[model samples]
Target: MRRTLTAALSIAMVVALSGCTLVSTLAAGDTPTDTPTPEITGSGDSTTDPSPPDDGGSDVDGSGDDGAGDGPPAIPSDVPLALGEAGEIEGRGGNPVGTFQVDGVTTGFDDCVEPEEGLSYVQVDLTITAEDDLAAEEGSLDYATSFALFLLYVKGPNGEYLGDWLGHECVPSSEWIDDVGPGESATGSVWMSVQTPVDEGLIEWRYGHQNFVVPFP
Candidate 1:
């Protein structure tokens, strides 16, 4: 129980520290009945934000509509992201968010606030790069995606999940040091911890209306 609450609190701190815009769902017009999200709200700055479709937020797939896609707009649906592979998405500000990769997941960080007992806090080494969209194909990704925040969760073998605007289960500690400008790249540490009891499971990046899974032990 300590691990669970501690993990939730730890990630909650990250959400507070990072300049993340609190969103109900990370994607477009749709819902994940099983996902738990954070209660913290964003700074109310939707400008250039890759927010949910319900917020009058524009789609990130370069489609003018509100991301009313059958699958995720950025990547094809159900395509799991492998370690070191980059998943790209365009922001609303005409800036493309690229080099979005999950480097690695680590636990038992010495600097973590959790007590060294039961399950320990997990950390995901992440990279979110902001790219220049000036050269983008005409009318392509006009909203040019920028790095806002990526919601995360851990999926059990049975398909159960946790974290974010709902409750902290496998939330990422992705508070950036500064705003990632075009042509600039930044690596943020994402934290995760499972409350229902398993650490070694599939980690999913809840991007907009789609989930890009990461195979992890």
Candidate 2:
């Protein structure tokens, strides 16, 4: 009887020891460990985000539509100049006359054969000098075609362009100069009829693709 009891106690002690070992192993396996996170770095072939698309907004260049219907380009600058102040003569034969200037501008003409209502006449006094002795053509200086080539117009205070006018009546018409030798000049007046009460305006002249402007007084 004593021997059997001792054997049974030995078996129980061995089983308890085995069960404790298994529990310890399971606890160790279930526990979590501290791990380090990886660092991120950019690649050499990385690309940047593209720019936004054009939304058809403001005009970067002055050539784009400004909401004001189609028309000639706006005035480059607002600098006021005078008619014939810095004019360059252009004609056949290398421009026999070189310098041209507007001596004066006269308005409110009292002598008009057929004056129309709501219109007034403006006379521009011009002095054209010859750079060299020009040969006389048909016993007179023939500048009718040259005068016709010039474009004369008016600009309102708001930069609106008025069409060209050609109905001129001068005592000595600019087209009828008798003769002009070197160091000599010819003086005359050219007239134009326009809307009355022109308080502030600009006289625009175009000659051979060149443009010039002068403030009207």
Q: Pick the candidate with the highest lDDT.
A: 2
Model 2 CA deviation exceeding 4 Å by range? 1-80, 83-86, 90-97, 130-150, 166-184
For residues 1-217, could you state the per-residue lDDT of candidate 1 as single tens digits?
A: 9999999999998987663433433444476588987786888866777755576554566677553544335642554778778876534332344556778865444444443344446566677775576234243332323443445665665556643222343443445223455677887665555444455666666433345677765
Q: Candidate 2 at residue 169, lDDT?
A: 47
TM-score of every candidate = 0.46, 0.43
Per-residue lDDT of 1-217 in model 2, one digit per residue for the tens?
9999999999999999999998998988865466767886777543664866689886877777676744333332232456657455533333434555666666665566566677776666666665543332122222333333145666666667643453554344434333345556677656666676455566665433235567767
Point out the worst 10-residue segment of candidate 1 by lDDT.
Answer: 134-143
lDDT of 1: 0.55
lDDT for each of the candidates?
0.55, 0.56
Give the Cα RMSD of candidate 2. Answer: 11.7
